[model samples]
Target: MTRHPVLEARNLRLQFGGVTAADDASLSIAAGERVAIIGPNGAGKTTFVNICTGYLKPQSGSVRFEGREITGVTPREIVRNGIGRSFQLPQLFLDTTVLDNLLLALAAREGIWNTWTPLKRHPRRDEMLDLLEVIGLTETAHQLPRELPEGMRKLVDIAMALALRPRLIFMNEPTSGVSTREKFAIMDVVIRALQHNATTAVFVEHDMEVVSRYADRVAVWSFGRIGLEGTPAEVLNDPDVRRGVVGS
Candidate 1:
């Protein structure tokens, strides 16, 4: 049986007045693939993710998830159709405990009306706890976001995104703003969690080492378009990518 790409964006063009945020850019990611998008700052990596996830609309072209056009769909609707994303900065409820944060995401995922129901009493609370264990954050579930370390907070944001049960998840700079020592450990947890859920991942990454370690394939975004696409060995080793994108 033939299977369509899990997500495909073709010939996308979005202009921001004089600057082109996405200039005739396109990409297709297969199911179960870990694709790392590499580029310098301002290279339109996030623009592609925003377009696909319905946070930003493109002036021209199409975004298809499972062969259905999702261009201009609301972000929530996109998520419903099996897509999710995490931002560069950890987006967490600083006032709430880690467990509650995921419970909220689970409520949102299942659309639970909980005005009268306590979150801990939700039927899916066990699932949330299991998720916490999967990400190795079970011990910290009672801690508030402000009380957790930055890396744990990042994992919580990722766990919330996973609560959506998306077939595909876009992670913006998954390793950015963390210490070098923590990057690999964080990525290990994330990739393991994704594999556990059978989810595909597309991450915008500036760290070449992280990309090389985690990505099955690499896409080099330059000047609002994809400059190269191939295995990490192929794309990461190219002269241009090494010089301009990798800055090594």
Candidate 2:
């Protein structure tokens, strides 16, 4: 028997004025696979992620999740179809406590947006607390985003995405904006949480170390298309990737 890919894009094309963001882009991600998208800046990695996750409408092509076409769907519809994504910047409520931020996410997942309701009494409060613990932010749950370090903020964003109980999650530069000393630590926590939930992940990352350590497969984008797709060793060590992507 054949298992279908969790997400698949075929012959995607997108453009902005004179710039072609995606050109004949195609890929498939199986369930539970950790796929990394890496490329030089402006190579359209983020654009492709946006298109796949329904944040951008491609000029042409199709996207399928679990064998059903989802191209041109709304972002919220995609989320409802079991896709979640975190941005390069932490998309958090800066004024709210970490716990409140997650509680809000849980509420959004449940289609409850009554902001007047007491979050502490929400039916899913315990689930939100468990997510905080999973992200290693239990002790700082009451702290505002401003009080938390960059790494913790990133984790909280990821937690909010996870609260949706997505089958596949896209993380755009999860390690960006954090100190080098904290990158691995942040990744460790994020990866552990993903594993605990048995979620499939696709991440856009610039750090070769992060890709090497965490990716099950890698796709390198160049000239608005996938130039290489293989294991970390195959993609990272390719002469073209070193020169074109790594700039070595």
Candidate 3:
């Protein structure tokens, strides 16, 4: 039997007026692979993720997941189809408890009417709790997002995405805005949780430490396209990658 790539992008291009955010970018990840996309500040990393997650429509190219061509799917459709994403900045209803947030994501994953109706104690709730435990936030499940530390809040956002039971996840700067001490810890929890469940993770990160430690492969984007794709050690040490980060 032939196994298919969990996600794939073919000649993806995202342009804004005369500016090209991402141009002719192509990549693939197999099931359970933990890959990192690394580049300098304006390397179009997030633009690639936005197009993949359906938040932005690319001017050209195609995105396919699990053999289905979903070039211009809506974010709702993408999530429903088993692709979930976490924002660079944690996007949470600040007043809501962590439990409620997870429940909301679960409800959304289950569909529309289910979200409005009172959430019943179900198997999914147990699953959410298990995820909370993994992210080290189970003890704070009743706390509101504002009460948690930045790292924990990031974890909560990730947990919310995990509740959707996605096959692939796109994370934009997963460790961005986090302190150096907590950055690696945050990535550890997120990577471990996803890999434990056989989910493919594609994250855009500026921290080479996290990339070296967690990424099974690294793709360096430069000049609106991919400069190199290989094992972390291979890509990171490449002269082109070094020049891209310093020169771009």
Candidate 4:
């Protein structure tokens, strides 16, 4: 039997002012796979994500989710299509409580806005709270984003993405700006939590330790294209991957 890819990008190309952000990049991730996209800065890692999540349109290429081509779909529509994404910098409602941030995400997914006031009695509130616990932020659920540490803030942002009940998620630099000491701790909790939820994850990360720990597969991007793809050990240990793409 042929296994269908849950996420697939084919010959993707994107350019901004003569700078190619994504150039003919292509890769496929099966359902339940945890893949890491890694490279140094300007590797077009984030740009690849932007195109995948519909935040940026490629000049030419195709993005397919579960057999359906979704090229050029709007971000909102992309979320509706069962793919969620998190930004590099934790994007959160700074003044909103952790619970409120998730609640807003739920409401947005359901497309129910009062226009004059917040809706009460969302059936998914309890579900959202459960997600908070999974992300290890249940104790601070009532606190505002500003009151939480950087790691917790990232958790909240991920929880918001999970609130949408996506089948696959694209996370951009999940550990960026976190204290070095907290990096592994945060990742352990996040990966374990997502596994418990049966969520498929793809993240762009710089930390090789974190990537080695969490990624089932690794894709190395360089010069705005995919340079290597294999298991973590396979890809990371490849001399070409090390000296040419990652080390460059």
lDDT of 4 by residue, 1-248 (tens): 55568989999998999899998999898889899999878989999899989999999999999988899899988999999888888999987788888889989887765576554467668887788877778899889899988888887888888888888999888898999888888888778767876779999998887888899999999889988888999988888877764573
RMSD of each: 1.3, 1.5, 2.2, 2.0
Runs of candidate 2 exceeding 4 Å displacement: 1-3, 113-117
In angstroms, give how far residue 204 of model 1 lies from its true place.
0.3
For candidate 4, list the clashing residue pairs, or say none. Answer: none
Best by TM-score: 1
RMSD after Cα superposition, model 1: 1.3
| Residue pairs that clash (backbone atoms under 3 angstroms), model 1 | none
Q: Estimate each model's TM-score.
A: 0.97, 0.96, 0.93, 0.93
- In candidate 1 the C-alpha lDDT for residue 81 amounts to 96
* Native-structure RMSD, model 4: 2.0
lDDT of 2: 0.92
TM-score of candidate 2 versus the correct structure, residues matched by position? 0.96
lDDT of each: 0.92, 0.92, 0.85, 0.86
lDDT of 4 at 94: 87
Predicted structure 2: clash tally: 0
Tens digits of per-residue lDDT for model 2, 179-243: 99899999999999999889999999999999999999999998789999999999999999999
> Candidate 4, 187: how far from true, in Å?
1.6
